[model samples]
Target: MLIPQYLFDAEAFLAFRIIEEKFHVISKSRISLLKLQLLHERALHRGHLKVAQQACDELGALASPVTGVDADLKTEVSLRHARTLLAANQFSQKSGNAALGLPYALASILFCQSFNLDLLKASATLTLAELWLSHGPSEAERALALLHGVFPMILGHGGLELCARAHITEAKCHLSDPSYSVHHKPDLVLSPLKEACEQLELLEYHELAAEAFYLMAMVYDKLGNLEEREKAAASFKEHTLALRNPQESVDDILNMI
Candidate 1:
């Protein structure tokens, strides 16, 4: 069973506040690592990573701990550390640091999945796919292999379409260069994404479905099908409008979008 939301939110918030306050004051490597590890856990729960690198820097300062922690706890700590490394690697790649994010990204995937946290597992896989397509195509093949394994997990959690579509969008960004043959048949990937969005719509996951439709528009735009693009855009508009004012009519939503 899922943990109670209120308790989870309360604990996460307290952890976040404590870590933010301690980040500057704690100088000991071991202490910093412990605090940052907790901070990373909270941030993951909230799906925000604005301070992920700073948290990772703290994690990197410590010597690896001796192997006394429970195996599950050890896995959790390792995965959190790997996520920090992945964040650092991505930042470095973006800021013209040497392209070395793939190893850390791959490690993050391996470790995060050790605990069966589906969101983190899917995220790591998706990030690896993106890193492969952008900074390393040979690595991208390895990432695809990893993705094949993780894809079923993502599907079980109803994230397969969203994850696939996001990867396709990232691939397009890198593949736009004629020299790169990164484009896939959108129908194959995008169909699942669309299905996922429809499912979300049925479940009243309006905000998520809105995001999905926005992504679909990106795919349609890339395919140069203006009609499909328009349709996706309309869906995005409708969903987002509904989210903003659930009582609004479809016509009103369309007008707002």
Candidate 2:
């Protein structure tokens, strides 16, 4: 939502400090694990690998005994661990270790993200996507398809405006398949989809706008308009590349559909 970069950075830095202080006091507690996970996430974002690794080590130690922990805390730890792997470029193999917690982590991250936990949400979603991709093209495609439904809920649940927009963009990229159409009726009206898109756009979510446009293209394609479909495809390609480097764009993501 056109959030100031400085504001985000400042908030992240503050959170990291608080988390670090909290960890020193309760390093052996489950709550410390939670703080470590978050601190590690912030460290990763700031490209502080040493700190991130230290946080990850603490999180890993706590991962096993998280059963009796609060559901949300457990979810946060799992998500943070997965995210650390993603940041390290080890997402391909390591994400599988956190597979079981992927969905829950994604949900929790979405909630936290909605509330301005930028670093946490970004790390979690990026990892969740990577974990899904590690399962192979079929699973990746499935994850992308489900994103349309899953993301809207996250947005409704109080996800951050920018992160939610990024997610919608990712979802649109995944759903770019001309042949992948769903016919089942959703339990809720599809109005939230439009509403979320609008909110993102109002918030200067350019990346998200690009994604919403791409998703609209998919809908147009499903309606059998060749001209409109081509326009949507082209727009998707344009915006996707603009938001990130072309190499990072999911250029062939539509192939899965």
Candidate 3:
């Protein structure tokens, strides 16, 4: 039940939070207050680190005093902090960053789940799996391991555009995976892709909806389902033209058929 309009408010709030995170807080007498300041600073430092171990430490810093945060800020920072961890995880996944991405990504996943932010949680879980997968075929085996954890979240959230996008993001992971299977693999992606398409249609996300059908068509092609592929291709064209002009006539889209 995440309303799209709330995003406008969220954007504004995220901006304000950035300012709050950046505005220097003078160290004070209270030990509890000092810990909170340390937590905030370390959370922000997540983006500054290139190594994974350092990022992990940064995550620890945030986690240690997370309880000290006011309830309201807890909700606000939970999502934002998760996003920052993912960012740092991506940046540090290679080189000296070591397993830094693992902790950051894991923390992000936990924070999202703790708050019942299903769409965000799903995205975070998929991202964590992807980080493990990037190590190659052996690691990719774990990519879908935690996907089930997020599925219920997605179902509960229903049909928001963000929910759809989250599903599409994870589905793409399976689609692009090198080790999914020698065959019968693209079939694995169809359900999530279809779910994404349905959600996008509900939200009137014309451009993205078109892309979803195009992705579905590609999956059908991979599965060697000629009839379904053709039908999907037809829908892809329809959605594409819908973006060009929402009221475009079927005859115009049919001309290429």
Candidate No. with top TM-score? 1
RMSD of each candidate relative to the true structure: 10.5, 10.4, 12.4
Instruction: Show the lowest summed lDDT stretch of 10 residues, model 3.
Output: 248-257
- TM-scores, all candidates, are 0.48, 0.43, 0.47
Candidates in order have lDDT scores of 0.53, 0.51, 0.54
Error of model 1, residue 10, in angstroms: 7.1
Q: Write the per-residue lDDT of candidate 2 for residues 51-105, one digit (tens) a residue.
A: 6666656665664564444544555655655555544543233434445546655
TM-score of 1: 0.48
Q: Kindly list the per-residue Cα lDDT of model 1 for residues 1-257, writing each as its tens digit.
A: 34433254346556655765678665545444555665554443223345444455555545455653343444444444445444444433354222355565556566666656666667656655555555544455555565566666566664433454354434333334344431466664466557766665654545546756776787788788799889989989987776666443333222211
Model 2: ten consecutive residues of lowest lDDT: 248-257
lDDT for each residue of candidate 3 in 18-57, tens digit (9 for 90 to 100): 5555854732223333333333333232223223223333
Model 3 spans > 4 angstroms off: 1-67, 71-105, 110-123, 130-139, 157-159, 162-166, 176-187, 206-211, 230-257
Which pairs clash (backbone N, Cα, C closer than 3 Å) in model 3?
51-97, 52-97, 52-100
Give stretches of model 2 more than 4 Å off: 1-38, 47-50, 60-67, 90-130, 134-137, 165-257
Winner on lDDT between 1 and 3 is 3
193, model 1: CA deviation in Å?
A: 3.3
